[model samples]
Target: MSTKKISIGSKPTAKPVQPSADEWVEHRGNGNGPEPMKRLTIDIPESLHRTIKAQCAMRGTKIADEVRELLLQKYVKS
Candidate 1:
């Protein structure tokens, strides 16, 4: 019996594909009157995420809506 050698090396990665700004806006708009909303992402603890999700479900609300309201209250000041 002969032993075979194994080669392990980093694989070449393909560049991430991103949509053009016009494409992104068109896709997001979908004829919805040109909403100018921007997307954001945040990292949170898993437990906190679960709690917020559960509370929103119970209140028949959306996580985005809750976050948007909190942001508006804090910064918009109107």
Candidate 2:
């Protein structure tokens, strides 16, 4: 005979928690620069996004391509 325990009202979940803006900025600069950004809906500042778009245009590439290239150069290479 064997006895096992497996009773719970609700199993614990490991949902990710969001950080405050200040924490986010600091955390992003911690050599890793925030985890890979998801390709979902986001509310980036218009000015920042516009600047990125301009850079993409100057580089003759799409915004996503520019971002990917920058990430590889800045993060992966390091």
Candidate 3:
């Protein structure tokens, strides 16, 4: 049996893809109006995540929708 040599070197780095301002806005816009939805990334404890998932399952809603509602209720003015 012939043994093959494996390359254990680091791979070349790729340039990051950056979105243009107009493209970014258009992509994120809701299309109803100028309401753009921004993506948010957050870290939460496993327990909290489980709780959110359970609540969403019970309500038959999405975690994002539930989180958005909660945020609006707490932050947005009536």
lDDT of 2 by residue, 1-78 (tens): 999999777877988888989999777756856655657356899999999888878888898776677778987854
The residue pairs found clashing in candidate 2 are none
Badly placed stretches (over 4 Å) of model 2 are 1-43
lDDT of 1 by residue, 1-78 (tens): 999999998987988999999889678767759657889999999999999999999999999999999999999966
Q: How much is the lDDT of residue 48 in candidate 2?
A: 100
Q: Please state every model's RMSD to the true fold in angstroms.
A: 12.5, 12.6, 12.0
| Candidate numbers sorted by lDDT from highest down | 1, 3, 2
Query: Which scores higher on TM-score, 1 or 2?
Result: 1
How far off is model 3, as Cα RMSD?
12.0
Query: Best lDDT goes to which candidate?
Result: 1
Clashing pairs in 1: none
| Native-referenced Cα lDDT, model 3 | 0.88
Candidate 3: stretches off by over 4 Å = 1-34
Compared with the true structure, the alpha-carbon lDDT of candidate 1 equals 0.92
